[model samples]
Target chain A: MGKYVSVRGWLECDESTINEVKKIRNDFTATYNEGLLGEDKLELYQSGWTFPEKQINWTAYVFYGADIREYHLDFMKKQLSEMANIQDITGYFLIDDHDGDYHLCWQIYENKFIESEQENIVFNK
Target chain B: MGKYVSVRGWLECDESTINEVKKIRNDFTATYNEGLLGEDKLELYQSGWTFPEKQINWTAYVFYGADIREYHLDFMKKQLSEMANIQDITGYFLIDDHDGDYHLCWQIYENKFIESEQENIVFNK
Candidate 1:
């Protein structure tokens, strides 16, 4: 039986920057040689793609050993920070015990720096 | 532009009871004469159908007049209670300003009666 950690995130970014942000996941997988489990691992549920005004909504899940969870989270944090136009990011984590059980454990959201930047961007606009 | 409320829920139920809970959505729609918009309105991302122990994950969004939001919430509460084998239900709400903006606002989860009931079921099994 394997213990798995699932991560889901909701983000807001410039419409032009969505595709670039998605590419980071692929790059991360290739660099580490350990990829997310399934086809839906990184699904972009919303992109403001169709509506142009709506923020982007994304969710991803990974199944890996418990010992490696922190490594993965750190990797994600670094990758997310590199995203140029991300105004806001709200994420949460879930765990699966491999015995048919899952639990949501934590959440993270945009910080003061991101908030101040967002304000500046909005004010400038 | 319109203002909208989004709802997301995570539930754990018996494998055999998945289909029954899904039908409640349809019944609600028919009774109200208002349907969830667009495709993927009620997406069942997980059902433990594959592993037999994982809980069910569901998410949905609706757009309508603000005056009717409470009416919809009360209606959902009634429908959810009618689910027979639901061990737990944790749900949250979000709001969209129709200007490409969204925010998560609230959450609800399983309670004591259901918790005790679930314990009995597990103990018996």
Candidate 2:
């Protein structure tokens, strides 16, 4: 009921990648399966469209009632990039406990994750 | 522990609306003030840039462990549109109960909330 990570981003995909994208989403939707991750849950949304940008965007939140799912973002990025059609994963994931002003902004990947120095710039709160 | 709604969209803002936008977010941030909202939780995220689009995007999730916050989206849209510089809420909100495939797609505003037929379109999952 406390810790959570926010995922806000989009995948650059083309016609060849659409089915794979949906398949990946079906995999993520498995988070709703009973007893999979305990109280941990993920509410994922895909909004916007390809008419304007030709890419679909995703907005999601991963909940950790008591334990943060370690390397969850890494797993997500890996899955997203492993697809043949996903050109890129653009955007960041913010780890927030709602108890501090500073939070981890996961945006860069250089063998591992890097913190984005944009909590105060790209966001207002 | 089950029901959740996802929010993903951006506000058309200028210099005049920035402060007010931050103030509204501050008010929403008060949801973490100890005992507010009971077990209900909200994880809100702001991302993207104003350089290429001149607008920032927000992705959020509102959890209703046992009770759905009725009229929550209505109140949100009202609050978002009541501001001066914020232009429009261009995206829709989807409500999935995790028990059915037919969920509510709320996007249209014609006096009351209208359902958006975008569960399959705009989204692959």
Candidate 3:
């Protein structure tokens, strides 16, 4: 099998965004059939939604044990980004990889997907 | 050596908070001398600040090749969270580990650091 990657992020928790994420969660992932999406191309765990009401409307979502081939992980991220408008979305995409486990961070600023320096956490097993 | 963990996160970008992070980064890491902090215990890379103006004042940050022994990584995280008031901070700690690279996400909501599901990105190598 291929190597594994972990994911975690935060977004504004609104009714529409929450519902859109819920739809994706339902549409993706396999129960007993073949694949979660179309064929049997990938397998991963996407966490449910939660409200923090921490100064801002926050919903912490997660996708663990993600398959990193053909940008499948990236595709899932794209789907989530579309859940709400850019103004309603102020989040980042932090993907860590090999050699030295360096983190590549991407964030939304003025409706553009910008890659810059930010902060995140990680634990190795 | 131990396995590697990747990190990427986002928070509000402010002059004071940015200055705090800049200080911590300076205090840690070994450029040429001995260890970063006090002794030769850990080796890590923490990224700098960036303003995205992405609807909200956003700063995407990162930590790569972090040392996890003796909770050094955890300590660094604690320091960063203290830079600003709870209302000015909103971030998630998505740590990835072995067996399947599962992500453990923790966030700050309502002035309390909460461990819940969130969204982020990861790429395996």
Candidate 4:
């Protein structure tokens, strides 16, 4: 039995906005020496995009390994809420391995509404 | 001056091959408690693809933060050479924040021939 997980989310923001947020978060982490949202996490990569010519904004991915639970999800939501100037969160995809198969869960946030669902999403070669 | 670096490489292999290689590498790490190729590294994610119907194979991305140098690149080449049945490395992308801007480099391996080049690859929001 092995455990591996990943989360991907896309955000709508400009380069300057993204850089500002990242700088703030990085400084906070350095000063506090604690993980974001009180959870041990590390950003893998954050990349900007230019698709449809001014339709899509920036996209970023973060990776962390810990017991996945409801508390962590709640914490993530609260932290995002506190951060200003962030909107239009398309959705979030969670991938975890359980019982020899990958399990996927999605949460979409639109118009201040949120919805959750589960599906079978596997990444195999 | 902040130093952040990332490397992206795509490999074309089958799912079973990817899983087998991952398991071997994981077990090796656990048993020996040493990084692959004598370098401290960690695999971020390995995902398969289905496109063009049996033409494209699996792809994987591994992330590790260390001082990027010639020795590490040489080590990576040697390790990949040792791994059998792995081929069709479309290319490898290197991104680093140098001089307050992002620098990009590319390497393509095809037909057993490798080419190196550089370009401006920025991921802005």
Task: Name the lDDT value of residue A32 in candidate 4.
Answer: 38
lDDT of 1 by residue, B1-125 (tens): 23433333233333444455566655654454345432332222111011112332322111111212223444444554554224443333233333433332333344311211111011001
What is the Cα-based lDDT of residue B70 in candidate 1? 24
* Model 3 bad stretches (over 4 Å): A25-43, A47-71, A84-87, A109-111, A117-125, B1-125
Give a tens-digit lDDT track for model 2, residues B1-125: 33434343333234444555666655654543443243223332212111122221332221111113333444344434443224432222344432444344444232233444332322323
TM-score (0 to 1) of chain B, per candidate?
Answer: 0.36, 0.41, 0.51, 0.41
lDDT, candidate 2, at A109? 29
Could you give candidate 4's per-residue lDDT for residues A1-125 as a string of tens digits?
22433332223334344554455445544453334333233222111111112211122322211233332344334333433334443223333433535344433344232324332221211
iRMSD (1 decimal) for each model: 19.2, 15.7, 15.8, 15.3
Question: What's the TM for chain B in candidate 2?
Answer: 0.41
Off by over 4 Å in 2: A31-85, A93-97, A108-124, B1-125
Best by TM-score: 1
Q: In candidate 3, what are the lDDT values of residues B14-108, reduced to their tens digit?
A: 44554554555555543424333443343323321222211111232322223143334465456555533434554555555544454656554
Q: What lDDT score belongs to each candidate, Candidate 1 first?
A: 0.32, 0.35, 0.41, 0.33
Pairs in steric clash, model 2: A1-A65, B1-B65
**Candidate 3 docking band:** incorrect
Prediction 1 TM-score vs. true: 0.41
